[model samples]
Target: MKNLKMKAARAGKDLSQQQLADLCGVSRQTISAIEKGDYNPTVSLCIRICKVLGKSLDELFWPEE
Candidate 1:
């Protein structure tokens, strides 16, 4: 359940975890936890992250087939 997609997308946007977290009103550790697959974000947080990264939920957070 490692969230490589989220990590890659964040890198593609040239954003640090702290920057994304700031944008989404979350803490850096929260972003780190998500990227590390140690935490599951709420839907609202997912949408905020997607918006900042210009990604859809499917692109950033959905499980791959």
Candidate 2:
């Protein structure tokens, strides 16, 4: 499923995909893939993304029931 929560949090922080990717030490395509559900990121990558967006892993990556 798409990680819309992460995308929203990134937008809320006023960051573009490239900015978020730089903060997380990944490429813009990686971030885009994550958002679009075309990729499943590693746990460490998820943590890095959550930290950059000021969100918890549960908040950004958990599957909603």
Candidate 3:
């Protein structure tokens, strides 16, 4: 499924995909793929994104009911 939560958090921080990617030490394509649900990020990558966005794993990666 698409990661709307991550996208929202990124937008809330006023960051572009490239900006978030740089902060997370990943490529912009990786960030884009995650947001688009075309990629499943590793646990470590998820944590980096969470830290950069000031969000918890659940807030971003958990599947909502």
lDDT of 2 by residue, 1-65 (tens): 88899889989999999999999999999999999999999999999998888889999998998
Ten contiguous residues with the weakest lDDT in model 3: 21-30
Candidate that scores best on lDDT: 3
lDDT for each candidate structure: 0.95, 0.93, 0.98
**Clashing residue pairs, backbone N/CA/C < 3 A, model 2:** none
Residue 54, model 2: lDDT of 87
Instruction: Give RMSD to native, each candidate.
Output: 0.5, 0.5, 0.4
**Segments in model 3 whose C-alpha atoms lie over 4 Å from true places:** none
Ranking by lDDT: 3, 1, 2
Model 3 lDDT per residue over 1-65, tens place: 89999999999999999999999999999999999999999999999999999999999999988
Winner on lDDT (1 vs 2): 1
Q: TM-scores across all candidates?
A: 0.97, 0.97, 0.98
Instruction: Point out the higher-scoring one by TM-score: 2 or 3.
Output: 3
lDDT of 2 at 64: 94
Candidate 3: residue pairs that collide: none
Alpha carbon lDDT of residue 24, candidate 3? 96
Candidate 1 contains a number of clashing pairs equal to 0
